[model samples]
Target chain A: MATVVAVIASTHHPFYYRASTSTGPDRPPFADEWVRKITAFRETLTRARPDVLVMVGSDHFHQLWLDNMPQFLVGKAPFYDANWYNEEREFGLPRMKLRGQEDLSAHVLRAGLDAGFDLAFSNELRIDHSITCPIITLRPDADLPVVPVYTNIFAPPLPQPKRFVQLGQAIRQIVESWPSDLRVAIVGTGHLSLELGGPRQFGPHGPDPEFDRRAVEWIANGDLDGCLAEVTLDSLHAPGNATHGFMDFMLMMGVAGAGAKADYVDSLDLFHTMEAYFTWYPNGVPEVGA
Target chain B: MSRYLVDKFLYTVDRDPELVERYREDPRGTVAWWESERANDLLNCHSGEASTWLRFADDERDALSTHDYVRLFELGAHPFLTLTLFIAMFERDYEEPLGFQKQYAERLSGFTLPYPDIAT
Candidate 1:
């Protein structure tokens, strides 16, 4: 049976990558700190050396549009890309293909269906910044076998937050049952508390810091249900939409499950969005206090 | 400055509504404060597209605010600027996607966003 060595999640924004290329005041010291944290997380991924990386992210009106969308879609193809918003010129991202584990992908899809969850599949999944930005940091130069999953955070008629976490457990089960001895790492991306195109979408306003802090606390405490119960859509759909990406966070918690202790958890904010990053270790969430 | 013309105008107009009052009270002075080498001169040479956008700033507050600032970014038939506003918002953060990625970048390998000349 394959061993799931790590479960990692980060609320990734294109700015996290683009700030690497901006000039002057825009590229402040704190901005530099953001990139540093991502790099450190990448280093951690390299050490894990999981044979397969399962990436889950929300589509930002790219790839999927209002006309057609899926709540949960998996990639059965052999590879995908993280290309958009100057990902190459600014983010130091090279255009490279990431491998996909077809057999494992099929098993994941089947596992979701068997668990009584409605799952979708895509054989030709071309990824966007949500998927690529982090990969650029994790493996910039070449190919890393990845299975891509897309969730509908932008569209309406959505599933409850708990569904996302449940899907995460299903993913864990599928990976655990795989016959191959492959090591797997799960990467979940996107954050809550920022409006995409609302009235304040581009305001110079800050997020509801308390909203962001409490959610991070719940996840850090390994309280996925508590996090879910606390973060209502109304809680997210505020003037700032501070918790807009809870689906992404919930899905991440589902994949990591409640048993795994968070080895590391930290949160930060750019003027527009507040981001939380966490890493889980099966052995234990180390004693080093964050 | 054409690079930042739309960005600069929209940001100055929408991001900081207070600047609207400043522009309303003293157009040239406001321009001088925000820009350096005479506001109109810079717009003519560097920020051509943003020239008219600045023009609307000189109108009666109501007319200027109605057509230019509040109406998004339409051009001609009040100019097709709404799409531009949408694009602008999409391209960059109205607030900003701030975090500590750069701190990690500096530690891991002195990474920073590309910087060009502009008074902060």
Candidate 2:
């Protein structure tokens, strides 16, 4: 029997990617202070060494379009590019293999449907930056096997918070029923606040410190209802708050189960970007185990 | 305002009059209905306040009021519904807007509907 060992949710602002490539020594989003925090977070995930990494994030119209959009889409590729968005220039594309677990993708799909979720299954899905950028932080060598799940939060008629949480529960059930004995890690990427392609894009693309602190606290405490309440769909979809991805966090919680505890590693308020990162463990040693 | 007018409109749209009246008094309920019934297509429609309405679970309905319904109507609900229903009615009522007489012939475009298996 496989268990979900860890659950993580973090911000995926393009500025973070741009900061990683900057030549300047400024320590704003990618400063030494922030780098150390994110590196430490990644270290915690790597230490877990889950057999499969289930990534829940939003698609910025990378693979599908409005003419034909799936409410919930799953990546069905054997392997996908880890730096699909970084290829805008002369950057080399890095492909991450799934460690021979393509069957798990189909299993998850079937289980999701059994659990009453209408998921969009794609056998030939393309990689996007949201999935790739976080992969760079977690697996620098890009060798980790991943199962990417796409949400329609970026588009309209977004899944309700309850439905999103149910999706996570479905993922947990699916992974638990797998015949193979494996450990799985669940990662949710996006922001607590900070919307893209809007007037909020002035300088630093971060979120409000108070709200971020509250959210981080709730997640660390494993208070699913509290966290869900704190993040209203309207508040998350507000002018500057891109908290729609919090639903992903809720799903991660479902996968981690009720006993999971999270540790806040990094909290970055870079310009208009609110990049908060956390690492959750199922039954590990409690540090700040709220 | 009058029940007769409301009933007439409901009959025209083939919607339940009581449901329409309920929506007039509680737009959030209407939003919930839309989400539960047409979630697949509704998810793709871009309405700024759709998330707000969808987030309201059954438990939270007690907090909603008639003012919210009025606000919903003011916030382009009528236009949205009218446009959507117009499309439906047009497809239902008319054989063809442009007469299907002598056809403007052209080469067959090789486009095909997406295969259901490959597309989830």
Candidate 3:
């Protein structure tokens, strides 16, 4: 049986991939504390050296918009991608190419069906910052095999927070039942609280602060009920709709379930969003020297 | 020039609600004074046809926020989060065969928030 070595969640916010323009050689675009948190998270991934990865994230109305959005989609292709933007393209972040997990993806897809999920399967799935940034930041190796699970929370009638948690559980069972000695990692990437183009629109007053504080606590303690109460569509996006980004965390919390242990926890209050990161050992924390 | 308005307009709205208010107050006056080649190109983006800037110029953000503008002009709000108005409004047929953004998603995924580290 395979071992679920680690469960992690993080912000796939694009600024994370850009190297800072700050002349202050040491100062990165994010706060020093944020930089440290990310580095710490990376260190954890390094130690785990996962052989297969599962990423749960949503598209930003960019690709997966109102046109033909899927509620829950799984990627079975052998690869995926993200286009580098203007200056980043010029400066050369280069369009990234990431490997996919075929055998494992097939198993998870089947499990979802057997579990009564009317899931969508895609062999031609292209990903975005939500899937790319974490790989670049934490896993550096562009060829790391991964399973991409796309969610729908950006628009109305989002899947309940409870459902995401349930998907996490289903994923764990499938991974554990696999016949390889694989070390697996599950990463849920996106925001905690954010708003854009809505009433609170921008700055000085955005991303309901109180909710952010409580929600992070709930996640750290694995409190699903607390999260469900706070994750209503209205609160997620009153002034701006970006609050949907939090869906990733909800799914992640579910995947971590009751037995997961918190190895590290931190949050960075960026201008438009409250960025957060957490690492968990599903069964128990890994040994230091191992 | 067309790209500049979309990019700059988005940046301004995200950081300067004040500018948003001003645009709301005098849409024509505000956009007119801003010198640019494609400053009026947004009006042409009405479902991929050339309408009149005057149509949207008077209502400030009202005309601009219309479904047409959101869906056709700026593509979507993801552009507001970055300076790459080009990505939001423009594209190249390169990333083919590898999960390339359906249409508007490439712009959304690549936008870099105007981090404080870079100049806001």
Give the per-residue lDDT of model 3 (tens digit) for B1-120.
133344345444333445445544555455555423333344312555432442223332343443223332233333234323323332344454212223334333343343111111
Instruction: Supply the global lDDT for candidate 2.
Output: 0.56
Q: How far off is residue A288 in model 1, in Å?
A: 15
Q: Is candidate 1 or candidate 3 better by TM-score?
A: 3
Candidate 3 per-residue C-alpha lDDT over A110-130 given as tens digits, one digit per residue, 9 for 90 to 100: 988998877898887778777
Cα-based lDDT at residue A240, candidate 1: 48
Name the better of 1 and 2 by TM-score: 1
Model 2, B14-106: lDDT tens per residue? 233345446555555654564455333332347542422223333223222232322222222221232222233232334642111101101
Question: For all the candidates, what are their Cα RMSDs to the real structure?
Answer: 13.1, 17.1, 11.0
Q: How large is the i-RMS for each model, in angstroms?
A: 16.5, 21.7, 14.8
Query: Which candidate number maximizes TM-score?
Result: 3
Per-model DockQ against the true two-chain complex: 0.03, 0.02, 0.05
Of the true interface contacts, each candidate retains a share of 0.00, 0.00, 0.00
DockQ of 1: 0.03
Question: Candidate 3 falls in which docking quality class?
Answer: incorrect
